[model samples]
Target: MTRVRRGVVAVVVLLSVVLAATPSTVAASSVTDQLIRRLNRQLLYMAVPIAVLVEIILIYTLWRFRGNDEPRPTRENRQLEITWTVATALVLLFVGTASFHALAHPSVSTIDGESSDVPDDAVEVDVTAEQWEYAFEYPDAGVATNETLVLPENRSIYLSITAEDVVHSVHVPELGLKQDAIPGETNLLRTELTGTGEYRLYCAELCGVGHSGMLSTVEVVSEDEYEAWLEDQRAGEADNESATDATNESSGGDEP
Candidate 1:
């Protein structure tokens, strides 16, 4: 029994040390991700010891009271009962209070509408989700693209998401942002990209048969590159508008 207990303790201690020394020590991109990492680390730190303790107690009890020739009535101690009840309540309260910061983080709220909960300097982008694809539209830049979300690094991106057909959820794990896109209702999520790289965007909820294929890319670029891309898009939009106007005039003259 002593050997078994020692082994369990050694294993638990090693695991606890490994968990504490790694993973969460790395830097996260956004505040939301950092908070989530903190919450996870705290939870694991609390849970591992409690789980090992419970297992040890179970093994000890089974070994100590294995053979019973005559079954005896179990006596309930009022003091013990009260002590454990209070202890459990205190533990729960402590955990809940500790988790409040992560649970009630402001970034998770979808307050008023599109512009709500967004910073003044944040760029707004419209996200439209359909069958198994996503369409990203930049009204300010006059650019609309399918399957790619372009943004400037180190800037807050305010995504106003809505579903054109069925319900879908936007999940960008690197940014720790996820929001449901419902038809006829716009949902907003804001997050800042710290590094310039391509992040994967996935539909977290099952929308249809092609739910697995509902994937996209979020490309974070430099401010200069973003500005140049916007300018090119605007120029293309102007040219298309001119062509449409000329076609409309020619068709009108033919009708007359």
Candidate 2:
């Protein structure tokens, strides 16, 4: 029992240390990322000590009371039992309060509220997901793309996410942003990009066989460069529309 307990303690300690050393890197692109990272660290701090203490107590009890002799019933120490129970309850209360405070925080939970944490000049992008692909549309910019998502860095973005087929999840790990895209329901998420870099966007949910292929890039560019890209997309779309219109008119004349 002592050996088993020691083994458990060693494994637990090693895991705890490793996790603490390599905590998830929060990009801190927005307030939500900061809140999430803060909460994670706080929980880790609380959990490690409690876990070690509990393991120690369990091992000591097993070693001290080990035997196959005639089972002798011992009277319960009510005060000791009460003390430990109360201690456990207090720990739970403290952790619960902390979790609730973080979850109820305004910056983390008010994604769709009327209150304006988002800037007035924030850009809006409509995100649509299907079984195996993502389509991004910038209505204001008159540009849409299926292969890549381009946005201006250091600016707030309001994302309107929806699914064309089954439910999907949109996740941008660098920004620590994720939102569910459900059919017939539009979910909104707001965040700001803190730097200009390429980030990977993934479908966090398993939609189908091609879910592994449901990958794309998020390119955060300067405002001027973003505008230029949008202009080029708009021009290409105009040319395609004109060519389609001409083709239809020529086909109609030939049929007559």
lDDT of candidates 1 onward, in order:
0.80, 0.80
* Local lDDT at 172 for model 2: 85
TM-score of 1: 0.78
Could you tell me every candidate's TM-score relative to the true structure?
Answer: 0.78, 0.72
TM-score, predicted candidate 2 vs. hidden true structure: 0.72
Q: How do the residues 1-256 of candidate 2 rate in per-residue lDDT, one tens digit apiece?
A: 9678777876787677657655566466655667778788788777777776776677667666777466678889999999999998988998898888877865455343233454678888889999899999987778888988998977777888889999898888767778888898887787677678888999999999999999989898999998899889999999999999999999999994
The window of 10 residues in a row where model 1 has the poorest summed lDDT is 108-117
Clashing pairs in 2: none
Q: Model 1: how far is 97 from its true place, Å?
A: 2.1
Least accurate stretch of 10 residues (summed lDDT) in model 2? 107-116
